[model samples]
Target chain A: MTRIDYTDLVGGLGLVLTGAAVSYVSISQYPLGTLQRMGPGMFPAILGVLLAGLGVLLSLQALRRPGSRPDIRIFSPLFVLGGIAAFALVIVPFGLVPAILAITVISSLAELRVQPVSLALLTLALCLMAPLVFVVGLGLPISLVRWPF
Target chain B: MEFLANIGLGFSVALSLTNIFYCFLGAFLGTLVGVIPGLGVLAAISMLFPLTFHLEPTTALIMLAGIWYGTTYGGSTASILLNLPGTPANAVTCLDGYPMARQGRGGVALFMTTVASFFGASFGIVLLTLFTPVIADYALRFGSAEYFALMLMGLVAASTISEGSAVKGLSMVVLGIIIGLVGMDSQSATVRFSFGVMGLLEGVSLIALAMGVFGVAEIIMSVRRVRTADIDPETLRLKAIKPSRDEMRRSWFPMLRGASIGSFFGTLPGTGPSIAAFLSYAIEKRVSRTPERFGNGAIEGIMGPESANNAADQTAFIPTLSLGVPGSATMALMLGVLMIHGVAPGPNLISSQPELFWGLIMSFWVGNLILLLLNIPLIGVWVRMLTIPYHILYPAVLMFICIGAYTSGFTVLNVWMVLVFGALGYAMRIFGFPGAPLLLGFVLGPLMEEHFRRAMVLSRGEFLTFFERPISAVIMALTGMILIWSVWSAEIIRRRRAARAAGDGATTHEAREG
Candidate 1:
C-alpha cells in the first residue's frame, strides 16, 4: 500500500488550478499572435500550459511514495501575518509610531509565552528607533504621528 | 600592463573614503546577519536594498557586494559554536565544526575557517579579475538566440539541481514567471495579470517579494524553534585560536582543493556556494586517508567546505557581471539592484561601467580583510548576539521587513504585498517548494521573455533557431541533457528506496517466523 503525500497532493492541485486560471484568462483576454510577432498572451499561454502539465505529473507522482507529515502550525502565521497586515493598515492612517506599536504588540503574541514588560519596552524602543533610523538617518518621508480624523 | 592599469583603477575607486566606509559598513552588517541564525544573506541584502536608492550606483553596488561575500566569512561562526548553520551554505561545516567546539577547539575551527575563507576569496577574486573581461568580450557577440538558450539553461539547472523534487522546483519557476507577468507588457503595452489594481501595473515589487519569501516567511518558520547558544567564553579568546602545526599542514591542501572546486562551480550558471561547499566536503572525505575522521572533528572537513563556499561566493559574480545572467537567486538580486539603478547589465556594462565593475571586484578584497578583522577579535559580540531571545528578535525583524518593504517604493501597498507573499511562501515551504528558484525565475522572467520573443522574431517563427547557432546549440543541448538526467536519477532513487523498504519488510517477516 502506497501512502499519498497530502502536501504534494494539495500543492499539485493548487498549481493545476492556478495554471488553468492563468491560461484561460491570458487566452481569453489577450491576443496571442503568430510566433514571428508573438503577442502578450503567447508566452504566458505556453508557460501556463506547461505548468498545468507539470502539476498533473506531480499529482500522479505523489501517490507512488510514502510521505512524512510536516508539523504545521497556525499560531505563528496568524499572528506574524496579522502583525504585518496591521502595520500596513495603520502606517498611512495612524503614522510610523503607531504602526510600529501595532506590529510589535501583535507579532510578540506569536511566541508561546510573552513578557508584558519586555514587549512594552520593545515597542517603546522601536517607536524611537524606527523614526531615528528610517526618518532622520535615512530621511524617508514617513510621519511619526498623524491624526486622520 | 593593461591588466595592472585596470587593477590600479579598481583600487582607486575602492580606496575612496566614501566607498571604503560603505564597504566596511556592508561587511559589518553582513557578518552581523550571517552570525545570527535565521537571517540569510538574501533577506539582509533585500532589507538594506532601499537604503542604496540614494547612493551612487558604484557605491551602492560596492556595499551590496560586500554583504554578498561577507556572509560567507561569518556564516561558519554559528556552525562551529552552536552547531547551527548561520546560512545554508555553512551547514556542512557543522559536521566537524560543532564536534571540534565540543572538544574545546572551537577557536581553532573558527580561526581556520576564516583563514580558509580569505584564501578562497582571494583565489576567486583573482579568477574574477582574469576571466570577467574575456567572458564579457565574448558575450558581446551574443544574439537573442544565444541569450535565450543560456537563460533557459540557467532556469532549468537552477530548479533541477536544487534539493527536493525537481518537478516542484520547476513548477515554482513557472509560477514565478506567471507572477512576473503581472505588469504591463513592454512590447505591446498590453496590461497583464494586474487584476485592475493600480499598483499591479508596476508589477509586484521585488523588495516586497524577497522580504515576503525570505524574510517574513523565514521568521514564521523559525520563530518557534530558534534557540540561544550556550557558549564557553574561554573558547573565543585569541590565544585559544592558534591551530597546531600538524593541523595547519592538513588544512592547507584541503583549502586549496576546495577553492579550486568552488571556483569552477561558481562560474557556472545556476550553481552557488551551498552546492560548492557540499561538493568540497564530499571530495575531501573521499580523498582523505582516514575518512572516518569526518564527523569527529577533522580539520579538513571545516577547511574544505568553508573555503569552497567562500570561494564560490566570490566567483559567482563572473556570470552575473559578464553575461548579465545570474547563477543564483542572490546573484539575481544583485542584477536586480543594477537594473533598478538604471544601469543595464550586459557585456557592455564592463566596458561602459568599468568603474562599477572593477571597483566592485577590488572592494571584495577590502571587505574580506574587514570580515577577517571583525570575525576574530570582535567574535565576542557575535557570540553575545546568539543569546538574544527569539521573542525579541522576531518582532524587530518583522518590523524591519514591514518598514523595508514600505520604503522600497514609499507605498503601503508593498507592505500588504509582503503579507500576501509571506502567506504564500509559508504555504510553499510546507509543500516542499523552494523559494530560491522562484526568485531566480522571477528576476529572469522578463529578460528571458524579451530574448525569447526577439529570437523567435529574428528566426521567422522557426522553432529550430535556438538549436542553429553554435553557442546556443551547445547550451540548449546541455539543458536537455540536464532535464533528462534529473528525471532519470529521480527514477533511480525511487527504485532504490522501494527496494530498501521491501528488504526491510522481508527481514521483519523472517524474524517473526523464526
Candidate 2:
C-alpha cells in the first residue's frame, strides 16, 4: 500500500546532477564561444541543459503523483549481476566466443534455475557456431578463433 | 522497362536455393522471437547481424528483412495467448485477444491476426512498390538544409511518440546527439568526446552501440523482471488454434482498415508501428458498435491493430530503401546492411539496383506468406517458450550480444559500452520513459549532424538557409505543428480528465486511484 515514488524522484534528480556535472566540466574546459560557433562542445552543453530541464520536470511530476510500490532489493537476486561484471572481463581472455558463452551461462545461472548440463551444451554449440558464422564465414576479423593444430 | 527487366533478374537472384533458405531461416527465427515476449527482432537482429557478414550481401539483406516481418506475426501470437504482447504494436491486441483466450476462442484470435497481418503486409508492399520511385526521385533534389530539416522532423516525430512526457523524450534525443558527436567532427575531422582514448579514434562501432543498447540492455532488464516475479506459471490450455467462419468475416474489414492506416504512417519518415498499432486500436474502438465490449474482449481489438502493426513493419522500409532515411531501428540496421553490401539505399538505388529493389519487394511477399504459414503450428512451440525459465535464457542472450559487438571490431570497448549503456537503459526503463525514441535519436543523430554541418558550410554559417528552401521550410513547419498538436492534445486530455473527476466525485476516485 505504500506508494512513495521516491525512486522516480531520485532518478530524475540524479540525471539532472549528472547532466550538470558533464556540462560544468565541458564548459570549464572550453568556453561559451566554443559553443557559440557550434564548435565541439556547443551541442553537448545544450543537451546537458535539456537533460537537466527534463529531469526537473520529471521530479516535479513524481512529487505530484505516486507510483507502483516496489519490493525490497534482494541483493541483485540473480547471478546475472555477477555475470554482468564478468561480461566485460571475459571478452579479452577467452576471446569473443568463450567470453560470450561464459556471460550467457553465468547470467542465466543468476536468474533461472538452469540445468548446468543443458546450459553448458547450448553454450558450447553457440560458441562454436556463432564465431564460425561471424568470424570464419563472414570474415568479420574478430580475434576469437584459431585454426586447430 | 529496364527496371522491369531487372525485376526479372531479381527473381532469378531471389529464387536461388541459397536465397530461399536464408529467407526461410530469417522468417522462422523472426516468428519465434515475435512469439516470445521480452525478445523481439531488435535483439534477434543484433545477435544475428555478425552472421550476415559470412553470407552473400543480398542473402543477408533478405534474411534481415524476413526477421523484420516475421517478428510482427509472432507478436500477434503472444498477444492472443498469454495477453503478453511480444511487440509494443501487439499491446492493442491484448485488449480483445486476451478476453477471447479466456473465452476459449484463442484459436479464432490467432487465425484472425494471421490473416489480417497478411492483408496489411500486402497493402504495405504494394504501396512500397508504387510510391518509392516517385518519392526517391523527388528526394534526390534535397540539399543539405533540406536533409537537415528532414532528419529534424524524424527526431521530433519519434520523440513525440515517447510513452511518457515529451520533455523526457527530448532529453533522450539530446543525449543521443551528444553520443553521436563523440567521433571526429563531421566537417572538421577534429576529435570530440574521445578524451584522448586511442580506440575512440575510429569512433563507436555501429554493431557495438546497437548490441550494447539493445541486446545487453534487454537481457539485463529481462533478468531483473524474471528475478522479481513471484507468480506461479499458468498451465496454458488452448482449446483450438483455428478461426471460426463468423470470426473471419467480422475481422476482414478491420484488417483492410488497419492495413490502410499502417502503410500511410509507414511511408512517413518518422512514424512507426508503435503509433500505427495504437491508431488502429483507437479507430477500431470508435467504429465498434458496443465499445463497452472493447477492453473486455472484442475481435476488432485484435484484427485492427494486428493488421496495422504488420503493415507498418513492411512499409517502414519505404523511406529507408527509397529516400535513404530510416524510420526505425530495424530499418536503420537494414540500411546499414545495405550500405555494407556496396548498395547505398537512396534515390539512385531503385534505378541502379532494380533487382535489389524489386527483388526485396518480392521477398517481402514471400516472407509474409511464410509468416502466415508458420505462425499457427508454431504457437505450441512459442507457448513452450514460456516454460523456458530465466535461469538458462539470459546468458545465451548476453553471449550473443557480446559476440555481435566484438565481431564489429576486435576491441574490448564494444563490451564495455554495452555494459554501460545496458545500465543506462535499465535506469531509463524504471523511470517510465520508452526506449524507442532514444534508439531513433541515436540512429538519426549522426545523419542529422552531418546534414547540419554540410548545410552550415554551404550557406557560410547562415542558419536561416534552413527556412529558405521550400522543402526544408515545409518539413520544419510539419515538425513544429506535430509538437504543438501533441501538446494541445495532452492539454485537452488533462482538462477532460479534470472535468470528469469533478463530476464523478469521491466514488470514482478510490476505484482507479494509483
Candidate 3:
C-alpha cells in the first residue's frame, strides 16, 4: 500500500497557513491585547498557533515516511447521502415528516433493504412523536409543516 | 466508614424508582451501542443528549452517567468476541482479546473483562467519594492560561497515543481544531466558516460532526462486505471459559495496577481513560515477567487495560463535576446541560449543593451495581446483537445518527455538516489520520476561546501574564515538552527501523559466509 499519510500532511500544512491567516486577522480586529483580563483576540490567536503548530508536526511526520494507504471506498452510498440530503432539502419545505421519512429510508438501506412498510410506519411515528413530544409536550413550538405552516 | 455513608447517600437517589429505571434504560442503550461495531459511546452520548431535554436535570444526568460507563463494559464484549471494538477505549482489549477469541477462549476473556470493569468502576467510585470535593475546589483556581495549556497538552497526548503514524495523528488534531473554528467567533461573535448559513451560526453541532465522522464513516468502511464473524455456539457455555486458577492469580495485580493508573491519569485534564488504557497496557507489558506472551491471548493484558479504562472513565467525571472543566466531549455536553439548568459548577458545589452533589456522587455506586448486574446477565443478549445482520442494524444506526444530528439543534443544515464530516472522517481514516483528537479539539475549542478572552480581559492584554502565572506556565511548559518528545520519539522509531533493515542485510551476507 502506498503511503497515504502524506495527503493529511498536505492538508495539515494547508490548515496551518489558514490558521495563521485567521490569527492575523483576529489580532488586527482586537488589537492583540485590547482587553486586559480576557480579550477577544487572545484566545483565537493562541488557538490559531496551537492549530498551526499541530499541523506542522503532522506534516513533518508524514514527510518522514510513507506507510500503508488503504484504497478509500465511499462508506455510505449516494443513497444514504441522498437520504441525509433529502432531510435537509425537504426539512423546511415538506416538514419534519417528509424529512424524517427520507432519513429512515436511506438509513435502512445500510442493510441495503427497502423495507417500505416498516420505514413508512417508523417515519410516521417519529414525525408525529417528534413535534408532539419535543415541541407540543415541552411547549417549545415547532411547525408541523415548514414555512407554510 | 465515610465510603459507606457516601455510597448510602448515592443509593438513596439512584434507587429512586424513577432514577433506577432511567439508569437501566441508559445502561441498556449504552450497552447496545457498545456492542455495535463502529457506533461508539462518544457519538452515542451526543445522539442521546437531545432525548433528555424533557427529563429532570438530575435524572437525566444520572442516566447519562450510566450510559457512559455502561458503554465501556459493552465495548469489551465486542472486542473479545468479534475483534471489532464497540468503543475507542476498548481498542486495548483488542490486543489480547481477539487472539483469545481466535483461540476459543472468548468466554474467559469476556468474564475477566467484566470483573475488571466492576472492580475498576468501584475503585473510581471510591476516588470520587474521597477526592471529588478537594479536587473540585483546587480546580477552581485554574486560570485561563492553565486551561489553554491543559487543552494543548491533551491534544499532544492524544496525537502521540493515537494508532498509526504520529504525524497523521497530529494532522487529525489540527483538522479537528479547524472544524472547531467553524461557527460564531467566541470573542467577536462574528460568523466564521458558517459561510453566512444561519445553521452555521450556532457553530457545527458536535453530534453532527461525530455522527458524520464516526457513525457514517464507519458504515462506509464496512460497505465492501458485511463484517459478519462466526460465533461458536459452544463459546456461550459459561463453564467453557472460566479463567484457570493461575490465570486468575495473574490478573489480580494488573487489575489493581490498571485501577491505580486509571485514577491518577483520569484526574489530568486530557489524559482520559483511553490514554490511560494505552499507558497501562504498555506498563503492564514492561513489568510482566514474560512480555512476549502479550498480544497472544494474555489474560493479564486484557485485565489490566480493561480495568484501567473503566477506572479512568469514572474518575474523569470528578474534574467536570467539581471544577467546571470537562475532560472529554461527553462531559463538555454534560457541562452544557448543567449550564442550561442555571447551575454553575465550581469548587463549592459539594458544600453549596450537597443534595445535588452528594446525590450524584452516591449515584455512581448504584450505577456501578446496576451495570454489573445488567452486563453479566444480559451478556448473552448483547452477544446476540452481534449476530444480527449489519444490513439491518446499521440502517437503524444511520437513522439514529441522522435524527440525532438534526435534533442537536433541530436544524436541517446541521445534517449536511454531519455528512460532510463523515466523508472527511472516512478520508482521514484511509489516510491514516486519527479522529479522537478532532473530538478533543471540538470539546476544548470553545472553552479555550472563552478562557483566552477572559484572561485578556483580566490581564489588560498583557501577554506576559500567561507566563507569570505559575500554574499556567508549568502547564504550557509541559505541553511544549510533549510536542517535542513526541517528535523525538517518532524520529527515533524511524531511525531504528532503518538501522534494523540495514542490519538484516548485513547479517544475511555474513550468514552466507558461515
User: Which model scores highest in lDDT?
Assistant: 1
Provide the lDDT at A137 for model 2. 73
Which prediction has the highest TM-score against the true structure?
1
Ranking, TM-score, top scorer first? 1, 2, 3
lDDT (tens digit, per residue) of candidate 1 on B3-64: 89889999999999999999999999888888889999999999998889999999999999
A55 Cα displacement, candidate 3 (Å):
4.1
Tell me the spans in candidate 2 whose CA falls farther than 4 Å from its real position.
A1-42, A53-81, A95-101, A112-149, B224-242, B290-297, B339-345, B494-514
DockQ, ranked from best to worst: 1, 3, 2
Distance (Å) between predicted and true CA of B48, model 2? 1.1
Q: Residue B331, candidate 2: how far off, in angstroms?
A: 2.4
User: Candidate 2 on B1-514: residue-level lDDT in tens?
Assistant: 8666756776777778888888899999888778777886777887787778767777888899998888888887777677788887788888888888788777767767888888899999888877888899888898878877877777777777545667667677777766766767665566766778878876666666666666665665666574312212232334465666776677888888999999888767557786888999999889888788888778878888888988898889888887787877678778767766677666888888876787777788778877777765666666666667555566667766776666555666876776667666666766655566666666667777667766876787787888888889998899899889877876677668756765787655334563
Report residue B414 deviation for candidate 1 (angstroms): 0.4
The candidate, 2 or 3, that scores higher on lDDT is 3
Each predicted complex: what DockQ? 0.76, 0.37, 0.41
Q: Lowest summed-lDDT stretch of 10 residues in model 3 chain B?
A: B505-514
Tens-digit per-residue lDDT, A22-131, candidate 1: 99999999999999999999999999998998899998888655567887999999999999999999999889999999999999999968899999988988889989
- Measure candidate 1: CA RMSD: 2.1
Instruction: Give the total clashing residue pairs for model 1.
Output: 0
**Quick one: ranking by lDDT, best first?**
1, 3, 2
